[model samples]
Target chain A: MTQLVRVQSFSVSSDGFGSGEGQSLERPFGSLDPADLHAWAFATASWVGRREPGGSRGLDDYFSRDFSNGIGAEIMGRNKFGPQRGPWQDLSWQGWWGDDPPFHTPVFVLTHHLRPSFSLTDTTFHFLDASPEEALATAKQAANGGDVRIGGGVATVREFLAAGLVDVLHIAVVPITAGRGERLWDSPDELLDRYHLEKVPSVSGVVHHLFWRD
Target chain B: MTQLVRVQSFSVSSDGFGSGEGQSLERPFGSLDPADLHAWAFATASWVGRREPGGSRGLDDYFSRDFSNGIGAEIMGRNKFGPQRGPWQDLSWQGWWGDDPPFHTPVFVLTHHLRPSFSLTDTTFHFLDASPEEALATAKQAANGGDVRIGGGVATVREFLAAGLVDVLHIAVVPITAGRGERLWDSPDELLDRYHLEKVPSVSGVVHHLFWRD
Candidate 1:
């Protein structure tokens, strides 16, 4: 049988903008030192190599390593594509990776715009104009037997979650708050009972919470 | 003068069982294969170090190191606290970090239940039975001059975001779709327009999209 799964997600804060204020783009994450957040890095598995002398090691390292398991393809949204507005131009935007991108598998981008197949050194970006269900079907096929992943600009994930399509959620709750902007988890409180807590840890003071269905 | 900021958030896929399956406490992240997901780790600055054969270095290493900046203090919800049901069980649950946790700083937990000023090694877990705003106030004070971080179990971050208290959001768009679970972007579409794209990339196929508001 085909088993579906959801990964982890969390919210980031932004400063409410003033009409006079320009896009400052201040990275509040920069307030702490890279070494200080070693714990969160470990949990998300976003960490790669050692930064300083005693960079990332030990349990943080263990969890960081644990983050990269399992499988298949990925799904994302256009707002996440880049600063570009309107329809996707071409494969020229090969993502933020310089040359050799990370994902070695096929990726499905959820978009309203119709675009042709785009390829990178190790990955292919296929545009999905259909509903999320259609996208999932394609991603699953592309993933083969592995598992289909959902990459989001929020809307995409929300669409799936509303349909009860996610299996697991590993969220790294950062220790920052934005007084304004987009909100996550505004649904009815009854929805809270759908899942149970799996793991919760303060990695380098960053809260890494995991949730799953009973 | 204190400056208020907006919240920027995106969603990512988790394994399955956001918190865990019907509540099976075993392997929360679920059987992960280390080799295939190396890219997911490389993008978020969430991973630690070592494990990969040629391992990871440079910008990939920066992914792990970048998280250690600007955080002064942290606040989290019970969801981010762990799978414990009910509450007030003593200082026994000093959090999953055990003693001498990775976070050598002060951490505040938003909870209905109260516990003594719990201390694990260098980190102190302060349980605040207060609203998100109140928690932010205390966290800011604890943060000194640095930024206050709000760690979440989902609802917590949503609460803050709706209140417009978050400042900077860094999201790593993972490649996976959950056929069922909770969502982060159920908010009205007009609310999300404030955030403009900051960065994006395709590493190992998984696209890492970061967003922020000036």
Candidate 2:
């Protein structure tokens, strides 16, 4: 099978905002609390933060369980890595994912300001100042035969999506609208020109809009 | 039972647009086609335009069936009545819905330029220059014991929605996005303070967002 560039389990609000304005360490999603938006995934059995037993089954659980499946590496924006901007101030700083980060594979962070690579547990972080194509090339190499996941902070996903590198995208559209934030789409129909779209509404009230390029 | 002022079977794109820009006689919804946005309702057995037999019999059909349930009168913006704007130069032009209007009751047309009220089949068109509250009150009186429907033109819906006069609002969130045109809400969450909401995704891919006042 050809290695696909995929986006999985990315959550966006009903009004199309990916992350709200003023993203910081304390508030990762800025004004729009991701916790509220991501309640569907949080209630799933396969959620990373699930400490208690017995989570939801079916549609939501399936997406959560398949999050890391068939994907080797992740390519995300600088903001998704952390809140630090304009040249990394702290060399000691790592990602927001804590001690055992989610991705067990190589991760690429897109940024203008470069930082030395570091490893935490099974995940390794590599900072690169490269075009979307170049970054994908690097990510694909690390991905090996497995597919590459385009993890997002909105801008990164937009960049890669605009470059026409994304193969399959799955966006979990939450019901709430964040009045202010960076929008993932002016309209999801913008992608319908190139990709076939399928909107699957889960029992949790989240509609999973899946787009795939043939 | 309390007489409700409801917005039933109103359609909006995924990006929140009620209609597209450049609305004219030929294009009532401007860029966004109401036919496409209302495909689910059209496919149902309760569609007004249905000629032959056989139509979908699911959630979409339920909404279509309930379109005229307790609705005794309709209050619509000038645009919804027709493409004509400003001073009504054409007195002969009845409406876009032909001789037999779908609304079989008193229809209050909100416009600054008033026209002599006329009757077509069972429906009567009454032109008025009134505020949302005033129009609604008039419609309620005309409706008798039945409910009044806030028929929309995007701007009119926004006005009634903002004025807090709407009792129950049903919006069909279609997957496509009309990038331009009038937006109904910045986010659906804006009305959460005043109303309770339930988003039910149908088999026909239309998510019906129902909001009701207590």
Q: Rate residue B165 of model 2 by lDDT.
A: 90
For residues B1-214, could you state the per-residue lDDT of candidate 2 as single tens digits?
Answer: 4677889889899888999998898988888888889898888755766766666534465467567766889999999998986788889999888888888999999999998999999999999999998998899999988889999978898899889898778888988878888999877888889876767787677888877765
DockQ of 2: 0.01
Error of 1 at B198 (Å): 3.0
Please state the CAPRI-style docking class of candidate 2: incorrect
Which runs of model 2 end up more than 4 angstroms from their true locations?
B1-214
Over A25-89, each residue of candidate 1 has an lDDT whose tens digit, in order, gives: 23222332223323356333235342332333322333453333345787777644443446666
Which pairs of residues have clashing backbones in candidate 2? none
- State the C-alpha lDDT per candidate: 0.51, 0.84
Candidate 2, residues A152-202, lDDT tens digits: the string is 989999999999999878899999988789999977898989886767776
Per-candidate total of colliding backbone pairs: 95, 0
Q: Provide the lDDT at B156 for model 1.
A: 72
